[model samples]
Each structure stands twice: as C-alpha cells, then as structure tokens.
Target: MTQTTEFDWRPFLLRWSGEWSDWSDSRSDDETRSEGDEAARQGRWLGFPPASEERIVAMEKRLGRQMPPSYRQFLKVSDGWQHAGGFVWLLAGTTDARWHDNESGLADMFEEDLDEDAGPDERRDAEIWRRGLQLEVESDATYVLMDPEDVDDDGEWAVYTWAGWRAAPPERYANFAEFMRDMHREFHSLRAHRTEGEPEFANDTTRELDALVEKARLMALRGEWERAGRTLDEAKEYGRPRAVGLGDQIRRLLGQTYMVYFEDVVTDPRYAPELLPSLVAEHAAHSYRDDSTLMFHLRGAGDDVVSSAYATLERVRDGTYRYTAAGPFGEAVERARELARWGDTDGAWRTLMDALPLWQPLGPDHLAPMGWVADPLLGPLLTPDRGRELLSTPRGGQAGEAPARSAGLDADNLTWLADPDAHDNLTSYRFVLVEGVAPEDLPGRLADGDEAALDDPMTSDEARRRSLGGQREFSSYDDRALMSVGRAGDRWSFAFDGDPAHFDPRRFVSPAAAAAAAATAAGAGARAVVVWSGLRTWRGNPFFHLSVARDGAERYAFTYADAEIHRTGEIPRALDPDRFFGSGSGKVEGEGHAEAERSLLEAVTGEFGVHLPRHAITNGRLHTFTSRSWTRAPGNGETYAVISLNLVRE
Candidate 1:
C-alpha cells in the first residue's frame, strides 16, 4: 500500500468498487487445488476481490508493516482490485500477501541490470530502483513499487513503475491519489471514446467523420489506452480512412483486449469453457493470408506466443492440423482442455507438448497461462511421483540445468572425443562454427590427422601481411562432415551477455552452424582455412575462435560466440605481426602468441543458412590464441591438443 499526501486515493476504489465486486463474484468458483498443486501458483494476476477485516489484519501483521492509509482505506472499501486504477497491479489480498522474491516474474525487475546502451543517468536510476519495494507486476516489462527510503512515519512512499522501454527515469506519481485521479478521467470518457469509434462507412472523404477518432487519439497520447481503444473500434471499417490511416482498427481492438483478457482468462477458470472460446473469437476476424505480413507483425514485434499461435492456427485453417491449438501459449491450455472434453486426448497432449518450448526458457518452474491444465480432466493421465518428470525430455535451450561436459569429450584421452593420447585432460569443449565458413575448413582438416597443416601454419606475418599484397590462392581441402556421427549434444547457449544464469540453450547444433558458416564462405568465394589448437595444459585456457577475413579478402566473416572474452582480444586488422604478440595481447610470461584484430559483429551473420537473426560473430582469434603455461602442477602435468572429429568435402 502507498500513502496519499494531499488527497485521499480511496475514492478511486469507491468509484470502481462495484465493478471489482462483480469480478470477484464471477471468479470465486475459478479457484482450484490443481492450480496450487502445480508446485507453484499459475497465472497469479491482479483482480479486486473481497477482503475480510480479520484477514486484512492478519496480512498486515505478517508483513510487519502497516498499509498506507489511502491504500488501507481502499482495501476496506473493496478488498483488492486486480487491475486497479487502470494500471496493472494484482494488489494482493489478505491471503496473497507473501512476497515471492525468488519468483521469475516481474519480481526480478527490482534487480534488472542496466541495458547495454543505458546511459550514466539510467544506470544510476537502476541502482536506485533496487531499493524500492515491488508492489505488483504492471506488465511483462514493468513493475509497480513503493520506494521505502523516500518515506517517513506517514507511510507515504512515492509510487513508480520500472519500465525498461521507457528511457526516462521510471514514471512516478506524487502519491496514490494522483495516480487514481488520472485513471478516473479515462473511464469517464469511455462513452465518448466508443461513440467516435462507431464506423461511418458511408462518409469516406469528410474530415468531419474523423473528428471523433481524433479526440480519442489525444486520449491515447495521454495514456488513456482503454478509452482510446474503444474509440478506435467505432472508427473501424475497410474504407474508413480514419481507422485505416491511424491503425488497423480490427487488430487495434483485439490488441486493446490483451491486458484485460490476460486478467479474465487467467483468473476465471470456472467460466473458462465459455470464456476461452470468446477469447479466441476476438482473434477470429483477422485473416493471416500472407507469411511475410505474419512474420512482420508477429516475429518482428518479438511476440513469440502470438506468432506461434497465428502460425499454428493457419495450419489448422489449411487442414495441416486436425484437432489442436499449439499455442500462442495462453490459449493452448484452454484449447487442449476443450479437445479432451471432446475425446481428443492425443490432440490435447500434443497441444500441451507444443507449449514446452515456449516455457522452457522460463526454466523448469513451468508456469502455464491459466495455471496447470487439470491433469485428470477425465483423460487417462500419466501419474508420476514427481510432476515435472511427467513431461517429455526437452532439447537444447536454456530450458533446464546446465549440461555437464560430455564425459566422452572431457576425458584423459578418449578415442571418441579424438584425443587418444592420455595427455592434457580436456576441460571444456565447444562445437565451433564460424558464421560464414564450412566446418570442413578448420574443424574438418584437424580431424583428418593432418598435423602438418597446423605444425607449419602460415606464420603471423605471412597471413597478416603477405596475404594482403595480392589475391593469393591458398590451398584448399574438404571432407565429408562426420562430426555429427557421435552422440554430441546439438545446441549452443547464449546466456545473458556472458552470464550463465540467463543462458537460453537452443536447438542449433554445431554441424548445422558449421554448414551455415561454410555456405557463407563458399558464396563469398573465400579459400578454405583450417588449423589445430594443441599444446593444451590445465594452466592454460583453450577455446575455438575464427578470425574475420583480412581487409583485402572481401571481409570474410567468421564467428566467436561471446562479444567479449577475459582480458584477451582479436588481432588488429592492420597492426604489424610483432605488435599483436606483444605483452599487451594474449602473450604469456616468457612466451609470445599472436593476436588477431577484432571485427564488428554487425556486418555478418549465420547467413550460413539458418535465418536466426540474433546470431552474430565476434572476430576470430584462431592463430593468436595458442599460448599455454607449463608452471601449473596438480594432475598428470601433460599438455595436450588433438583432433576430436573433422569432416570436409572431398
């Protein structure tokens, strides 16, 4: 609860009290044991529900803090409202007061790191935001909070929302009163908003016809979205220039319902049978005839769930699916349940399975949009001692635990991982793929037992200096890509920047990445390049990296997954060879190693074939990264580097 200084904010609740009570009466039967039994609560959203005096007192005592008088008075007037004051706040009720600091919701926004491009001022605000008490989840990208440090005995903490998209300091209100007043203004205008939105299909050319929508547009600019949307609806029609020019009104109305719909569809489980179909019906009007437009509106918007839903529904519309909705996630649960009631259990199960990839990145907590689909909703459900074990094995995505190194590759010289010599123990291994090169170029050559290729690798100056003088034809070789023959895992994870906690493992395997890289190399008319990284030691760090093509070589794009590495860097494009191996670079004590130039990641991509856009290459440092220290002594003290697998085109 937040205090109101000059004005009592409780009127906001009083004005909307009946609206909230109606919601509670409608949703009371929706509560179930299944939602709670899922190891965590599912779809916990904001709604105004009845609160008892006794329950409110207990909740206050439990939190060890008194509610701000304005908010406290609000609760007394009408328990707690889910989406109160037109802002997103699932203001907790008496029983829902416990804070889930560990929950993966907007609760994490308190500790969100500054954006990479965040300025000094924005960074300072994030540091300040860490101190605020999170009040509720405003949306996926934002949260409401009361800053305790800024308050005193009056319990008047300024309320603000932490929204990442907003470049300014998170918007703040003087108190709950101001916030409520602003919200009240919009609801009062709903009539005008909707009146202007009614279509005048016959008046195609007159500016007078568009006047109503123009008024609603001003409301939208002032953040009166719900009213603006209703007004936009009235203006909707195929020939209505007002709606067409302003936005696609049919879609705009559907978009407007998203937030309110999230609250209703998630909390009203008892009415779900009818509510779910009605929710889907809102989307039924839009026809997705072209893939490009679909991709633009869905993928380009970065909305995976909606994009997947549109794609899945398209398949159903085209006869590619029989009896399922594989999701935009939230709808899938309802669709699956409906299918089961109709005796399509297999379809229901498939629908649920399709959603696994969607939540995998959210980790094993596995939240559903409407909580858990009742396991025994009458179909033969698979019972297991552990609920999570009931789900199928998920493939590469930061969906589960960090995979331990492959025992086959991280061994004392196993033949399968290619190093038969019981020398330097393998600590880590990554299936390397330079964005625009074939796996046959480097990884392929090393696997072929061509030790001579690396032993007399082109000297630093030869490749860095001599190669720049002319269009030289370097020797090339290729073999069948055989690396996929073994039981190697097929995925690469991009943890948040380089932090492992937020790593999202995906299904892209190395061979596929290599093939992508190779295709790009071929298309660029670049010569094959391959080399071995050996002389391994426990004291030294080893990693696979590909260098970008030098200046004269059509700017060959290679790959390195991380944008930054520990204290080491790529060689400069035009620096002399000696300068690269100098102490400032990867040079070890009493040992020298060449460094390669760092290249911009933007100009290239995994255009090797996969259309994934987030993928980018950090310039390679292949030749310059081979320095190992022999000073360490613990295990069998032998340094090693040998081929694991290599296949190239003959």
Candidate 2:
C-alpha cells in the first residue's frame, strides 16, 4: 500500500487484540483471567463495539468539526481501543472524545515555553496543544491530541503525543493512521523483548514482509543497489522493521546523505578535507533551530594541525578556500567536490565511488583508506568482487614502477602469536599473556568472577566466528569483548579476541589497563603481557603494540605505527630497546618495520620466558569468556581514545 492509500487498520487491530488475548490466557492472575474468560464468553475481546455513522456524525457536530478520516474510519471498525500504547489504558470513543480543557494549566506552560527565541515549529506545537482534541480517556500523564487547525489537503489532522514524564517536547505525527501503525510495531517490539516463541503476527503478510527485508539486505551486500532499493521500498510499504534502516543505507550510498561529524569523520586523515566543508555549512544552516553546533564546539580540542584544518574548512564552507590535491585519487576527489559545488550530486557520487577502491593514504597520519567493510554506505558498494580486486592491488609506488610485495614477517619466530594469513590484507589478531595462570582458570580470573564469565567456555575458532558473525547484538562496548583463553607456557596463559569490521579504539579498554587487569586477576606477584598487531583491511598501514604489567600495574607499553614509536614507562633491561634493535637508540636505521616488530617480540619472549603452543593457537580449541569485565565506559569519560599515551621515549 502507498502512503496516500486508506490504510487498513482493522488487521493491525485484530492481530493486536489477538496477541493480547493470548497473553491474557497465559496470565496467572485470577481476577484478570476471570475477566478475560468473561470477555471471551461474551464474544468480545478488549476493543469496543463499532460506532454507528449517525453517532460519529452527532459527535462531530457537537465538536463543531469533522474528525480526521483515519480516526473516523477507525471508530467505525472499533468504537475505541484498549492499551493504545505504553500505559495508555483506554482510547476515547465518540462519546468520550472532547476538547481538552486546560485545567492543569498545560496551555500556560506551553505559552511560557514559547519565549522570544522559539522557532516556528515550537510555536506551532504550543498553539496546537491549547486547541487540540484529547483522545486518551486514561493515562499516566500521557496525552494523544489531534489539532483541528493543522489539517492536510486530505483532511487529516496532525496528531501529537505529550507526556509529562518525557524530557523532550511533544512528538508529532502526520496522521492518526501512522501513529496507530507505529504503536502496533511498538507492541511487537515490546512483546519480542518480554516473551518468545510464536511470531508477533502469525500471518502470511508478516512472513512476506520479513522475507522481503532479508532479501533486500543480501541484495545490498551483493552490490545489487537498484534491486535492493526497490525491494526495500516494497518492504517499507509492508511496514517491515528493518526496511527503514536499510533504505537509509541505500540512500546514503546513492549520495542522498553525507557522513559528517565533529570527530570520526573530521579527524579521519582521509576525506576530512573533502567532507568538512559540507559539515560546516550544514551545521551553520541548522544551528539556529537545533543548537547542534558540532563544529563550533570543536574549537581548541587539538593542536595547531586541528586548528588549521578548522580554519581551512570554514574558508571552504564560505567559498573562499583554494587548493587542488595532486594524485589520481586526489584529483578524482577534487572533481567530485566541483561537481558537488555545482549541485551535480549524481555525478559527484559516481566519480567518488569509481575512485574509492584506488584510494591510498595521504600521509603517515592517514591510518587507513576512506572506506572498508564497516562503512555503512561505501562498504556495501565494495562487493566481494570489488573487494578482492581492491585487496590484491598494491598501492603507493612511483608511476610505471612494478609494484613490490609487502614485507612479510618471519612467522616461525612468533609462531604462537603468528597469523597464518599474516600476509592477507584483512587479517587482524590480538592476544594477552598472563604469567602464573592456568588456561581453565584464566577466564574467571580475568573477569574477577563476574557473571559475564559464567557462560560455558567456547573454542577460539567458535568465539571468533561468533564475534564476526554479525548476529551478536552488542548494546554496549563492554559486550564487544568475547575472547578465547588457553595455556601458553608452564607459567603463562594466553587469551584471544576478535575485532569487528568497524574498529574504534574508543570502544575498547586501554591496552595497558587490559594488560594490568590480567596481571591483577593472576593475584600477587603476577605478570601479564598483551600484544595486538594487524593491518587495516585492504592494503592499509600495519599497527603493532606491546604492553607489560606486573602485580596489577602497567610497567611498559610500546606502539609502532604512524611513522613514530610511542613508548610508555621505563623499559626494563631484560626487554631493552637497544638490545632488540641494535641501534642503542630505538630507531629503525637499516631494517624494515616487519623485522623490527619481529625482533621486539623475540626479545619479549626470550626475556619473559613466555611462549604459546603454536598448534593450540592455530588449530586447537581453547576455553572462552565474554571480556566485558575490562571494557571502558565511554559515557563515564573513561574513553580509551582520550586516555593519554603517556609516551616516555628512551
């Protein structure tokens, strides 16, 4: 059905009532059960009998206005409804619906809220509340109102919901039909959380809608854009739950939206210059109405480089900026910017997408390419075929020069921690080593006997598969860490965890803290070392880190990336930088980065007397735990991103 069609509310109402009846039948309460039985015996459920046309017309005449077509038609099907939504006990029938008398001084409060700074929408919202018809017969300070003056061409009155407990302004709807349909979906969502077993709507239509959404998702992943768009459109008409999000994603890839933000997008070394101008312009345009000053608040959050970037973005947004990037991909981005300036969004998106796979980092600070598997818009565009080509193709070399192979680390040296596919473009791996801990006891120790460690242990492969499966719905960063644990050496235990396609350092606990926690979990005089090494997917930069902790305190941490070495805390002589690099200074003078990292790891293994069984890490199973115990809480300002590097170079 289309938006303009007279939506059939009867089926939704019937299904809702049926579900409620089933729930009622399952209830243990004697009074409620007897009431439900009496209603079933009387051939009636929760909904009221249909109102006669004459009765509806009389009520309309008394009110001196016509009720919205949707609401009037709804009364014809059922005079009133019970449990309209969230604590809404009863909806008004023709006999009960009336003009809301401002007895609670709600209109006065609305008027007080409309100060000199209020926008057109806010003013309209306040005016409607004073004049709208009240629909709720019983509620906990919640209201469903219809504004007679806010009529559409189709004679549909705008609906508004005002709840005293809600911190935000009243929510508005285009019409009653949309509101009811949303409530029905809300019913299903709520029921899905409270109960399980049968479908929310055990009908062919629900199954069809679900199947259509699933098909659209698969189509999008396969880069069947046009087909996926059309399928999602069809699913949206069916009111499928995931259709809206999928449709938004498709629209984003089609250049109908831009990914602009204060940090993630702007701080990204790639595409920031191309995207910041648009972000600034959009923020400026909406600042008056929404007060969402994303760019405005970024003043002085970083160094001169950040400030310079901001200034450049402001100039670009104001049409006074000048610069032309110098390479094939850069030139393509410049052309896209020009097309975007001329409002040729279609051309802009086409040019950008065509050059995306060829993207190389501008500098050492540009850690990864513009888009990879996790990007909501660009990711889907890089289908399996395109992805394979993108990964296999090497980037960054003199023009006409034969592409050289990437330097491979000697896997035999770090066999226990070596990635079998270390040369694979998308491969990433992480593991923690704790001294004085057993494989079976490590999970409990690491989690400090938290309930999160209560799950039956899983194998390393099984845990990795689950983390990468996309079926695990993590509500928080803490839920993101699911790791497998195993014995390393006689005195050491190792743990492994998987990383999602979207890697955010902010979502993780500090590497040092993670290492420290492992040591603490092993009790007195325990030592823990953690190592994380990986290449960002598809010919991206290599990142490697090593941290050591003893007796619950971090001792040393070293990071090798961004063309710089970051060291925290004093280096112990046993794992000395001079001995490992032979420079006597921690600088790579005459060796490749892969060799340097391998040498560093070799020193740590040789000194600490810690090593993992290669077979156990590569092919064997190990016990697992959900690693939420050490996850950093971003909301509490314990964000891993903001944590200082505490770099102490020696």
RMSD of each: 22.9, 24.8
Runs in model 1 with CA error above 4 Å?
1-11, 17-53, 85-89, 98-124, 127-132, 137-142, 163-169, 186-192, 195-650
The worst-scoring run of ten residues by lDDT in candidate 1 lies at 493-502
Q: How displaced is residue 522 in candidate 2, in Å? A: 62
lDDT of candidate 2 over 1-650, digit per residue (tens): 31323878677677777766665555555544445345742453567889999999999999999898999988998888877765576788999998886655677888887889989888877776668899988877888888898888888888888887887788888888877776665555454334455335444455766787776655444445567678867666555555654564445333344433423334544545544444444454455535335635454344543665557545533434544445677677677554333223334445655564455545422322332222111222333333333323334331222222332211323533433353333246666777776655555546544533533333355556654564433444444456666555556666666453333443444443444454434256677787766533232455556778876778887665544456779977766544544443345432344555566667777867665444333333345665543444567655333222343699
The C-alpha TM-scores of every prediction are: 0.24, 0.39
Q: In terms of TM-score, which candidate is strongest?
A: 2
Estimate candidate 1's RMSD in Å. 22.9
Instruction: Supply candidate 2's per-residue lDDT for 461.
Output: 52
What lDDT would each prediction earn against the true structure? 0.35, 0.57
